[model samples]
Target: MAVIGSVAEFTAEEDWEEYCERLEQYFLANNIKDTETEKRRRAVFLSVTGGKTYELLKTLLAPQKPTENTYEELWQVLQNHLSPKPVVIAGWYWFWTVRQKAGQSVSQYLAELRRLAEKCQFGNFLNDALRDMFVIGLLDTAVQKKLLSETQLTLDKAYHVAMSHESAVQQVEEIQGASKQQVNKVKEHRDPQKEKGVISAEGHPMSQMIVSFEKSCVSRVVTRAM
Candidate 1:
């Protein structure tokens, strides 16, 4: 809610006051126990914006060059000094923190994405992640049992791993009564198998061996990426 931007030059006089009010409201909205830590974070956030928000304010505020990191240097300072961190760490922080406060529902995050898409950077990632998380909740048993079985738990997972994916969600269908569409979607996004041709030492076809080899390569890629 804190409208971080330059003070003396960039922000309009009225907008600065509005930003301060929003910042206060945002902190109150969180209701977290770390009031003291949050205060320090907020202070750093304000200090940075008050000084640096103007350097690029003309470009950011102008219609032609609305760049996202209008306060990049300030953000660096806040991330370094704050504990529990302020909502200025990354472009995604505002949406992520708001999701945290709103019970961490997939629906809630999606709602935020809808709002953010018009104004925020990395909007694509947030929307994609939220949709994927919902699809996973629909199909995966472990996901359902661990996160979705309960409202709050599901909400929490929605916030933390809204963008996470399980590699095998696609191929198998009908896992605990999930929709076929969901399964198909997972399969659609996942990487296709790159089959290494199966040939025995004698130059005979070895279909099973080829399948095994491809699976091994895919597994290794996934493991290393993780």
Candidate 2:
């Protein structure tokens, strides 16, 4: 049967869990079922894994040949090699101490918390742990207070509330900034007119003083002539 999908060579830089998931999907698409002889699936897996990965697997299997192991065994061995489990205590410490960094948005911070929580083994308490960490890590005091005031806060609720608060603050700042600019423009527009009025008022008084001085001089000259 023709295969419907292709699997790329697994690399050290790639996530092992994600790659495994994709590989399983490829198997399903191609009608490669476990009910068939284990040998067929193993051969198919070994063939498509590429030379570099096969060589690594050969080195890992060592004393035994790849053919001696079943498909499930080979997959398990690679999983153990590629994705070693993290220490639970250290993972928990990192998860608890993490805070929302400056310039990071609420969603970005939430993604980081989820990533750290993967190794924490929180099990059934995962959502509660996430919600608590999210509230503690927030840089916005108002958002923190709002979340804290909620009686039935879940991770979903916290995320939505924080996002809404952040959006509202940005909109308010934009409006206030625009208002200040408009006020300054109006003041600038009136300033030239005010200055011109002041100049006209001062000139009128100066012209009257000059006329009075001229009249006094003429009167003095006439009296002297008389």
Candidate 1 has a TM-score of 0.22
- Model 2 earns a TM-score of 0.78
Report the C-alpha displacement of residue 65, candidate 1, in angstroms.
Answer: 36
> What tens digits encode model 1's per-residue C-alpha lDDT throughout 1-226?
4443333322433344345455545445554226456555445444545544534443334553323333344344333433223243453454344432333544454565556443344444655545444444343345445454444443345544433434333222223133334444444554344323542322323434444555665566445423
**RMSD over all Cα atoms, model 1:** 17.4
lDDT of 2 by residue, 34-109 (tens): 7674687898789878788888888999988888999999998998898888899999999999999999998999
Q: CA shift at 126, candidate 1, in angstroms?
A: 19
Task: Single out the weakest 10-residue window by summed lDDT for candidate 1.
Answer: 168-177
What is candidate 2's local distance difference test score?
0.81
| TM of each candidate vs. truth | 0.22, 0.78
Measured by lDDT, the strongest candidate is: 2
